[model samples]
Target: MRRRDLLASAALPLPAWASAAPERVLRVGTDIAEVGFDPPRVSDRTSVTINAHIFESPLTYDYLARPALLRPQTAAALPEASENFTRWVFTLQPGIFFADDPAFGGKPRELVAADYVYSIKRFFDPRIPTEHLFHFENAGILGLSELRQRALKAKTGLDYDAPVAGLRALDRYRFEIRLARPAPRFVQLFAVPGLTGALAREVVEHYDDELPAHPVGTGPFMLQRWRRGSQVRLVRNPRFREQHFDSLATDLNAEDQALLKRLQGRRLPLVDAVEVNVILEEQPRWLAFHGGEIDVLELPPTLAPAVMPGGRLAPYLAQRGVQARAQVDASVRHTFFNCEDPDIGGLQPERVALRRAIALAYDNTEELRSVFKGQGVPAQSMLVPAVYGFDATLRSAAGSGDMARARALLDTYGYRDVDRDGWREHPDGRSLTLRLAGLSDSRQRAINELWLKKMRLLGLRIVFEPGQFGELIKNSLAGTLQMWSYSWTTSQPDGDFFLALGYGPNAGQANDARLVLPAFDRAYEKQRALPDGPERLAAMRAANRLMLAYQPYLPHFHALRVDLSQPGVEGYRRHPFTRDWWRYTAKE
Candidate 1:
C-alpha cells in the first residue's frame, strides 16, 4: 500500500517518538543490498540483519554472553522440553500485541500462540521458496513434512487449517511441538527471529504475495520506509510492550558493566529510529563512518590496520571519543565447487582429482594477507572457533597450499597442456576453463585475482563472473554457478549447519555444493542424533574427512570482527549469534 493509503487506513495518532529530535535517529551502513524482508525467502546476512528488529521470536541471545546464551523474548520463559527432547512447549507472554496494521481492522491485535504456528507452516507451503526449509525438515517435525508432500502431489496450496498431530497450539498463549527424533538443541531454532518470527494469519492472507513488503510483527520496530537497494528507515513501534534492559550474564567486562549501570532499567530501543544505507564500496563506507555520517561501522578489513592499528582504536579516533570492540567471529570463508557440475563435480576419479587439485593449489595465506589485511586466522577445518564440535587437535589438508601435489594429481588424472598453450586440457584434449561467481566489488576482485594466479600456476584457465550478491545467491541456490566463494556464519553455538553444507538432503538449501555422498550423509545424521560426547565428536570428524577427501569446498579463514562506534553512541557491542543490536544502543 502507498504511504498515504496506509495512513488513511489507520485511525491512530503518531507515536510520540515520531516527532522526536533528529538525534534520536541512528544511521548505519551495510556492505550490500538486502534481498527483501520476507524471512522465508531471504538467505543473505544483510536482509536478516534488517528484519530481526522488525520481528520477534520465542527466544533471543543475551547481549553480553561470550559463547552465546539463549533467553526468552516473547516467550514467558525458556521452553520446557520432555520425552527425551522429542516434545517441546512454549508459553507466550500474556497481553503482547503486534504492531498496528490495516489487517487488524484498525483495532489492537493481540499476539497469540497460533501466530507462531502459522509462521512456521508457511515454510512448507510450496508456493514460497523458503530457504531455511532444510532447518525445519532436519528437525523431523512430525506430520509437517507429510503435509508438505501431500500438497506437492495434489498440486494445491497446503491446507493450513489441517490439524497436524505434532504441531498445534495448546491454548491461546501456549503451543506444543512433537518431533520424530531427539533434538536437544532444537530450542536454538527459536533464537533465529528473522526466520521464525510470528506472523498473524490475517496479515499474511491480506498481503498474500506482498508479505515481504508488508511485514507486521510484535517487535520493537516497524518498517517506516524502504528504498530498495538504497536505504531503509525503521521507526519505533507505537504499541511495543514495556521492557527493560537486562541480562543474565555473570561475567561482563568493565565496558559492559558501565553500560548496564547506566541503562539497566531503561526502556528498550533506546533510539527512536534506525536508518540503514546500502554502501557497497568499502572506501565510501569507511569515509562515511570517518566523517561522522555513519554511527557504526564493522571497520572494513582493508582499512583496519591503518584505522585501528594492533586491534586498538587509533589515537586519533580515540581522541575523537570513538569506541571499538573486536572479536574473532564464528564464521568460515570457503570456496565451494558445485558438485552437480560436469567439469569439476561427481565422484568419478578424474572429476574428483580435478577438484582436489584445485583445492590443493588454493593459497589461503596470501589471500588473508592481501585481501583481509592479515586480520583473520587460517581455518583448519570447516568449523570455526567457539562453536561446538570444533576440535583444534583435528588436522586436515583442505586449507593447505601445495602446488607440486596439485600438479602431480592433475598429471595423473590426464589433465595436461595437450596443445602446449600453457593451460591444461581434459583427457580427450578438451580445453578446461573454470568459472567462479563473486560479488562485483574491489574486495572480491582481489580475492578473484588470487584465484587467477593460483589456477595459472596449476596450468588451469579460470575466469571470474562478477555480479550483485543477491543475484549470485540465486544462482548458487539453483546450483547453476560453477563455483563461488563466501562465508558461512553460525546462528547457534552448535556448528552442525556447517556440516549440513554437504548433507545429501540439503542440496537445494544450505548445501550450495550439491554434494550427495551417502557416507557423508550418514556421518552427518549420526552426529546430529548423538549427544555431545566423544561419539558425536568422532562422527563429526568422520564427516569432515569426507569433505576434505572430496574437496567439495576449500576452507579459507575465520575473520576477526572489529566494529567501531562514533563518540556519543553508547552500549554498542557485537553479539556472535544475533544481529539486532541496534535496540541496545543510543546516540547523543
Candidate 2:
C-alpha cells in the first residue's frame, strides 16, 4: 500500500444524524500504529489494545479495581485446581456465541471448550509463527511442546483435527489442562488478551495465512471497518452475551465512585461504537483531542508540561472541563545491548566493564527532567511498581552517572583515543562505533542527542539508526541490531514476567537482547517453579542483582501515564494492564 493510503482513514459516508449532539461513540487517539489484529501473531501494544475489544479471554482483570483483580469472562467461573497445581479444569459459560461470519456457513456457532483448545494450539503451530508461544512453552504443559515438534516434522502443518493429551475437551463446555510440573501462576496467563483468546477453527481455516486481516471473535465489539495503520472502527456486537457492571471493593475516589454509580446495573458495552485514529506524531494526537475530534487522549511525556504543568491539570484544560488522571505506569523503558554481537556481547571482563561504564554515563534523571517534563520517576531497577519482587529499598549502581569512574574503566580496558582525534578506538586498535536503533520522532531524536553528548564526553563514538517502532522491533528480534531502546509493560503482576527476558532459551523471543547466562537462567527457572511467596521473592532478587551486575540493559525511567477526557465522557477508567476500556465508556 502507498504511504499516504496507509496513513489515511477511509472516508466513509456519515449517517444523517452523525453530526448531532452526543452520539454514542467513544473516539480515541493513539500515537503508535497497530501491526495487525491477529491475536496470536501480534505482540505490539497498539495492536493488542485494538484486539482486546474484539476478543474475550477465558478470564480477565476487573476493570475498575485497583491493584488488579482477576475475574471470569467467557469462563463460567474460576478453574478448579488440583492440590499439586498440575491440573486445571475450566467450564465455559453457556450461550456465548461468536459474531456472525461466512466461515460459520451462515449458522450461529456457540463458543465451546474445543474452540479454546484449538485457539491456544495455534500459538505452537509453526505455520502461524507466534512470538508469545514461549509463555505456554515455559508453563511445562504436558504433551504441548512435543505435539508442536511432531507437527514441525510432519508433511502437513499442525493437525487442528488431532488432539493433544494435555489439552483435552472433557465435554461441550468443559476442558482440562495437565502440566508436567506445578504452575501456580498459570491461570493468570489466560488474562492476557492475545495469549489466550478463543479462536474458531473454521475461521482460522477460512482465512489461513490471511487471518491477520480477518479477525472474528465473540467480544462486546466487532471490527466493522479498518484502514490498516491509519484507523479502525468497531460496532457493538448485536449477538453479544448479556453481561452487567459487576461490583468490587475498590479504592476509587469520590468522582470515580459517582461515575460507577451512574453505570451500575447497566448492561456492558455502553457505547454504540468505538473509533480509533492512528496518529503517529504526539503533537497531532494531542491536537485532535484538543479540537474535540477525539474523546480521550493519552498525554505524551513531551507535551505533559503544557497539558498538566507541575503534575496538575493545566488551567486552560481545566477551564475547558477536561479531567486528567496521572499515575506511575506499570512499565519500564531501557536500552538493551545485544549479547550475540561481538563488539558489545558476551560475559568477558572487558566487555562487562565497557557496558557497565556506558550505563553509568547515561543520565536517566536528566532524561526524566527534560524529555519527560517531570512526568516520571527515575527507575531504580528493571522491576516496575505493582509487580512482585520490586524492592523499593534496592537501587541500581548505574542510576546516577559517574563520569570519572566511567572514563577510568574505559581507559583501563584499552578503549583510548590512540590517534588523539578526541574519539576512542577499540582495544584491538580498530575503528569503534556503537550503533543504537530508535524511532524517528522528535522525542527519540532528543534522547539520542543526550546519549551522543554523554558518549562524546567519554571520547566514544555512537550513531543513531532511525526507523519506525515496528522496524526496530523486527530488527531486534532478528538479532541484527547492536543496541536499541525499548520498553516492556507487564500483562500480569509477576516478577518472573520481567526477569524471564534475560533467559537464554527466550533468545529472539522475549529475550530480545539475546542474553545467555547459565547462572541467570537457573535462577529464573527456580523462581518460576516456586509459588508466589518469600522463597520466590528471594530467588527473583538474586536474579535481578545478577542482571544488574551484568549490565546488559541500562535502566531508564518509569514514566507516569497521563490521561485526559472531556467532562461529557463517563465511566472511562484506565486499566494498569488491559486496554479494553471502550466497552465501559460512554459519551453524554
Candidate 3:
C-alpha cells in the first residue's frame, strides 16, 4: 500500500460513550516573558507558549493527525492552488457567532472574507516586526510586496478601500487569492502555525498613527491585561467565538475517543476558565506541578528524568500517579557552524574542511547516552527518523568516528604540526587555534566541552568564549564566533519544507551552520517543483544525500515533551507537526 494511504487508513475507531459535557479550564505554566499576544509581532516562544487561551488559526489538525478544516465553511471545500501555483479560494463558514461580548456594549459583526485578507496583510506590515516571515514567502500572492510596503510606511493606509493582489470579496461570504505556483497545500497553510484570529481593521486603523499597543484578535480569549517583563493575562472573551485554533492550544491536540464520538451534536467546553502564567525559572514549576497549581508543564530538562519513565523522576512520577510520554519529534536539535565569517579564517574551502573535520570527530552516541540519558538519536542525516524515508545507504555514508582519520583530513588540508610540538598549525602559517561560543544550558555546555576535548586530542588549541546569552546570540548570528553549539527547533513533519531542506530565499537562516551547497540548492528547488509525492521524495532523498555527504551539522537530541493533567482534566494529546486545536476537549 502507498505510505500516505497506510497513514490515512489508520483512523480512529468508533467510541461507545456519547454524552455532552461542560467546558474545561486548562492552566499552563511558563518561565519567561513572551513578545506579546499579537501573532504578527515577534516569533517569541514565551508568548505562543500557552494554547486555547488566545490566538486562533482558521483550520486545524485532527486526532488522526490529518489537517482537519476547523471553520465549518472550510470543511471538504477549500480550493487548491492551480497547476501553475498561482491561486486559491475559500468560502467563509456560516451561522457562526462571535462569543457575545457585553464589554463591547454591542456584538461583533459576522466574520467575512475581508477579515482573512486583513489578517494576512498584517504579517507583511513593517510596523508588526514579524521575525518569522519565511512562513509566507511561498504564498506567491501578487501585489503582496506593494501591500507590505504600504503597511510598512511610517504612517500609511491600514484599511483596504478596494481590493489588491487579485483579492476581492465575492460578496461577504467568499474570498480568493491568485498565487505564483500550483500550491497544493496553500489553503492548508492557514492551518499551519502562522495564522491567527482576524484583527479589527478599525482597531488597527485607530492606532495607525501610533505604535500598536494592544492589537485585537477574535479568539476564545482576548488580551485582558499585559504587564511587561512580569506577566500577561487573558480573560474569556465573553463576547468571543469558541475557536479551536486559539494559538495557545493550537499546537497541542486535545483527543478523547469517547469525547469525539459523543461530541457530534454536542456543545463544546466543560470548564469555565483557562489560565496561563509565566514562571521563568524551573524550580517554581517543579513545585507547582506537584502542588497541583498548574495542570500542564512544558517539561524542562531537570524535570525530564523524574516524570519521565527512565530517569530519576520515574519513581516520583509513578508515586504521583502521572502518565508519561516521550515524543521523538521532528525537531532536529543541532550545532551550527558560522561558515561565512572571515575571522573564523578564510571564507573558502579551508574553513569548510576544518568544519567538516570537527563534525566527524565528535561521538553522538556518548552525548545522547550520558548527557541526554539515551533519549536522543544521532542526526546522521537531516530528515527526522520516522517522518521521511531516511535511506539507510545514505546514513551509512556518514562514516564512523575516527580521530586519526579526522586528523589526516586536517593534515591533507595543510593543517599540520609544523613546530613538531603537540598542536597543529595552519598551512597558511597561522596556529591551529579556535574559540567556541556556547549557551549556558547544562546540556549545551556539556556538548561544547565534548567537542573541545575531542578537538584538543586532535592537536588543536580550543577555548570557550563565554558571555551573557543575549550577546552570545548577537555575536553568533553576526558570524563573529568561530564555532557554536545551539538548539534549533521545529514543528514541521516533512523534512521537504523550507525549514530543514530548502535553501536560498527561506532555505532557513536558523540553520546556524549557514552553509548552502549548489547541489542542495538544485535538489531543494527541484523537489518542490515535482507535483507527485513519490517524485518529491526521490528528490529529497538525493538532497538528503547531498546534505549528509558533507556532514555540515551534527544532530544531537529531540525535544522532550510531556503533559501532566489533573484527574478532572482529560483529553490532552501531543500535537504533531501540524498544530492541532482543542474545542472538543472537556472536563469531567
Candidate 4:
C-alpha cells in the first residue's frame, strides 16, 4: 500500500501496544568516527554502518541466517539471473516511498528502478571520487567502462541521458544489468546496502555536492541529525512500507531459534530511534557502556583479559545481567609495503628479498599474544576463513616468523652493517631505513613498538610516522607512504574481494600496496570467469601464491570480536556479513 493511503486518515487510532508503551531508543558506539553518509563516497566501516540504516538496497541478508542467506529488500523477490550469469533482472516492490524530503516538494516520492540505475551510474562519474569504481570495472559491466573512459578523455561530465547497453531500466519497477563476462558471485553486490543503495535522481540533482549531508531513501529509518564526525541520530521512517520480521532462520542453534521466535512478526525498527556516538578511545567507550550511556559495547582487545578472564565473562558482570558473545571476525590485518615507493618498491631480486626478510622476521604469534590478548588466529593468506576459496591447509613461509632465515636472506641480498653502525645497509652501501605509517592512538603505539623491536632485532633501522587514521588512508592511496598497517573486513561471502587487494587495476583503491604484477592480475581475472569448483579454487590459490611470493603485504592475523550488551538490550546479535543491526534490536 502507498504511504499516503495508510497515513491519510486523520482520526486513525493507534494500536494498544504502541499507545501504552514508552518510546524505544537504541544507543550504540563505534571506535572510529564516520567519514560521511554518502555510500559511494565513503569506504570506512563507521560510515557504512550509518549509511546502511538510511539507504535501501535491492536485497539484504537474512537477519537470522547463519550462512548469510540473501533476501529481497526493496525488490519484490530475488533477482533473476541469466543462465550464462551475464544478465540480471530485478523488480522493485510497488508503493515503497522515500522518506519525506524537500526535493520532492513535501510530497512522498516512490522508489523506482531508475533510482538504482542512477545510483550505479554515480560510481562511474569522473567527477565523483569513488573507491568502488574498480569493482564494476572488474565485473566488465557492458559499456560502462567505455563510457567512463569517454568521459575521462573528453574532460566532461558523464552524459546521464546517454543510453548504455549494459544498464537500463526495463520499466517503472524493473531494471536489467548485462555483464560482458560471467560473474557468478556478482549477485552479492545487491546485498550490500551501503555500496549499492538506490538514490533518487531528483535528490541528487537538488543537493549536488551536498548530497552526502542529505541522504533520502526508502529504508526503515531516516537520518534525523548528524554532527559530522561526532554523532549520528536516526528515527523510524513513518512512511516506510509495511515490513514484518521474518527469515528462513536455517540451521540456527538453540539460542538463535529463541531469538527468532521472539522477533518473528515484530515490525522493523523495533526501536523508535537509534543514536550512535563516535567514541574513538577504548577506555571512554568502556566507561560509557558500564555507566549505561551505551546499550551495546564492542569490547576492545586490551580489555579482554579484565572483562573475559580465561575467555569467559566475569562473575561480577554476569551477576549484573551483562552478556558476552565472541566470534572470530571475518577480517585480515596486514602491514602493506608500497610497491610504488621509490625506497622499497620494485621487482628487483634485492628489493624482493628485503621485503621477504621483513615478512619472515615479523612474528604474528607475538602480536596476537601481546597486543590482541590471544584474541586472534594467525592468518595464512589474505583470504579469511568465512569466505569461499579459503584453503586451511595452504601454507606459506611469508606468514611464519623465522629470525635466522630472515638474517640469512638479508645477508644473501648484500644487506649488512658496512660501517659497524649496528644497522643494515642497502646492496649499494646506502643507509637503509624503513618508515611505517600508523595512527596516533595508544593501541597503535603498542603495535608500533612491536614493529620497532622486530626490525631492530634484525639490525634494520625502522621509524614510526604517526597520523590520524583518515590521513594515513589518504597518504596510502596517493602512494606516498612506504608502509602502513590496517585490516580489511569482507562484506561478501566470496573471496574475490579479498584477492582484489593485489590486482593491479585496484592500485589507488582496494590495492593499497599498489602491486602491479601482470601474472597475478591474469590469475585473478581467470578465476572470475570459471565456475566455483576445484578448478576455480586452484586458480585462486595460484593467485594467492603469486602475491605471497612477492611479499608486498605481511599477513598478520584474523581478529576475534567480543561484544557485550546490557540486560535491557534485546534481540541483539552480531551478524557475520552485515553491520546494520539497530533495526533488529530494542532497549527496555
Choose the strongest candidate by lDDT. 1
Candidate 4 residues 1-588, lDDT tens each?
Answer: 332232222122333454456868788888888776778888777888778888988988998887879989999999999959999999999999998888999888999999998989888999887778887888888888888889999999788878899999999999999999999889898888777888888998997876777788888778777775677778788887888888897798888888888889988888887888998889999999989898888898989999999999999999999988899888899999999877688888899899999999999989988988889989988889889888899877765669899999999999999989999999889998999998788889999999888899988999999987777777887789999988998779888998999999999888989999999999999998988999999899999998899988998998998889999888887777787688788677
Per-residue lDDT of candidate 3, residues 215-270 (tens digit) = 45545554444455445554445545444322212333444335454444444333
In order, what lDDT does every prediction score? Answer: 0.87, 0.83, 0.56, 0.86
Please estimate how well model 3 matches the true structure, expressed as its whole-model Cα lDDT.
0.56
lDDT of 1 by residue, 454-543 (tens): 899999999989888778888888889999999998888886878998998999888999999999999999899888889998999899
Query: Which pairs clash (backbone N, Cα, C closer than 3 Å) in model 1?
Result: none
**TM-score (C-alpha, index-matched) for candidate 2:** 0.95
TM-score of each: 0.96, 0.95, 0.78, 0.95
Clashes of 4: 0
lDDT of 1: 0.87
lDDT of 2 by residue, 275-382 (tens): 899998888888899999998988888888777777789998899999887788889988898888888888988888888889888888888887778777788778
User: Between 3 and 4, whose lDDT is larger?
Assistant: 4
Cα deviation at 76, candidate 3, in Å, is 8.3
Error of 1 at 499 (Å): 0.9
TM-score top scorer:
1
